[model samples]
Target chain A: MKEMFLIIIFIVASLLGYRVIKEVPSLLHTPLMSGTNAISGVTILGSLVSTAYAVSSGSKFLGFIAVVLATVNLVGGFVVTDRMLKMFKS
Target chain B: MIGTYEIVSIVLSILVLVGIKLMSSPKTAVQGNRIGAMAMLAAVIVVLAYNGIIDVPLLWFAIFVGGVTGYIMAMRVKMIQMPQMVALLNGLGGGASALVALVEIFERYKQMTLFGRLTGQLALAVGAVTFSGSLIAAAKLDRRISQRPIILKNHGLISNAVLLIIILLIITASVANISGIGFIAIITAFLALAYGVLFAIRVGGADMPITISLLNSFSGLAGAICGFTIEDPLLVAVGAIVGASGLILTQIMCGAMNRSLVDILSGSQLNSGINKKET
Candidate 1:
């Protein structure tokens, strides 16, 4: 039941995302890619939860690394996209 | 009845969608990026609170360090290097997803259902592949590696064999005992990494945009699969959205290049006489 729900969510989200992203112009594809790249850091939520529940020190360490990596991807991606968008504005 | 976490996750996902919707125009793109960042911040906070990990100093420290490093890197990177920078960050994101899936497979192995086990292993493979593929793409884009296609003899056969082995490993890991599962997972990751390298190394500079976009999609798909293992609705939805966005970009790139995705993926375009003439 839960898996089915998740699958539906995935399908719906994908359809909506395709529609929304299609509206972006070719000129903005780079920034668009970077923006979506930042969003992919959504994995940070999973990393945090899993790390919190982790039992072994090794797992915790791995989780910590996951957090750091996701953070870098998120922050760096958004900032870079912002910078690029700003260039267009100027 | 819907729980607080469910409500929050749904609302946040909507906000993220709105953020992306705002990105369609250059005038609103900066604001869109800010909104996306803000939504991410809120999601992180909610996860911490919901999981009661809000006070975990180690997590916070890691975030702080990563945040500082990412900011610095973003500020220092030249505009010419944007493609590589995005590729590098995509690699990191995929790497992180692989790590999370790795830890989760071990942490929940004993308690996990068959579905959980399968999804966990799949995520690990996808994430690992995305990580290595994006890194190679980034290196190629940055000119650290030769921009020419590095096709070995019978490259297609080798990649197909590796992919087959990965599928077998995933199936084996799904049913294996906990002790054996760990070893299987490690081997699977190594193979997936190899596959990623093999897959990316054959694409010349001309097809990098498509390669990057495909890898980007893989990263999101990795995260979405990881979400299934953990049963997180927000992660599943947001990751799917990202995956879809990447796929759309890949399609656009393919159209722009006047090549089929299959031609690009199979490396047929690289050696085609038509390609040379067109270029």
Candidate 2:
């Protein structure tokens, strides 16, 4: 039952995302990609939860690394996108 | 029945959607990015509180180090380096997903349901591929590697064989006993990494935009699949949205290049006589 609910959320989100992203002008494609790229860092949530729950030391270490990498992807992606968008402003 | 966590997650997902919606115009793009970042911050806080991990100093430290590094890299990168920077970040995201899935497999394989096992293995494979593929794409774009397509003899045959092996390994790992699952998962990651390199190495420089976009989508799909393994609604929804956004961008890039996604993936366009003039 939970899996099905998640599947539905995935489908609905994808459809809406396609519709919304389609409206972005071609000129902003780079920023658009970078912005969405940052959003993919959503995995950090998974990393944090998994790391906290991790039983083994190795698993905890891996999860820690995952957290760091995901955070970097998130922060770097958004900042870069913002920089690019600022270029257009000036 | 839905709980408070679910409700909050839904609201946060909506906020993220609105953030993306605001990116359609230049005037609102910076604001949109800020909103997206704010939503991400909130999501992290909520997840930490809900999971009762808010006090984990190590996790906080990890975030601090990663945040500082990411900000410095973003500020230092030149405009001409944007594509590779994005590619590098995509690789990191995918690598993180792969690691999370791998750890999950190690930590919970015995207790996990069949569905969890399957999704976990799939996430590992996709994430591994995205990680390596994006790195290669980044290197190529940055001229760290040859920009020309590195088409080895029977490249298509080799890539197909590696993919088939990955599928078989995923299935095997999903059903394997706990004692053997870890080994199988490691082999699967290695093979998937190889496939990623092979897949990205054959695309010429002219096809990089589409390649990067497609890998961007894979990173999201990897995260979404990881969400299923871990049963997180917010991760699933946000990952799917990112996946869809990347797909849209890939489609736009393909259209702009007058090339089909299939051609780019299969490397057929690289060898076609008529298309040779454009590249």
List TM-scores for all candidates, in order: 0.96, 0.96
Local accuracy of candidate 2 as per-residue lDDT tens digits, B1-279: 489988998899888888887886788889989999999999999999999999999899999989999999999999999999999999999999999999999999999988899999999999999999999999999999998888899999999999999998888777765578888999999999999999999888778878988999899999989999999998998898889878988888776666777777666655582364452
Model 2 agreement with the true structure over A1-90: per-residue lDDT tens digits: 998988898899888777776665778777888888999999999999999999999999999999999999999999999999989888
Model 1: which docking level applies?
medium
TM-score of chain B of each: 0.95, 0.95
User: Model 1 Cα displacement at B34 (Å)?
Assistant: 1.3
Error of 2 at A21 (Å): 1.9
| Per-residue C-alpha lDDT of model 1 across residues B44-91, encoded as one tens digit per residue | 999899888999998899899889999999999999999999999999
Cα lDDT of model 2 overall?
0.90
**Residue A12, candidate 1: C-alpha displacement in angstroms:** 2.0
RMSD of each: 2.0, 2.0
Clashes of each: 0, 0
Which lDDT value does model 1 have at B163? Answer: 99
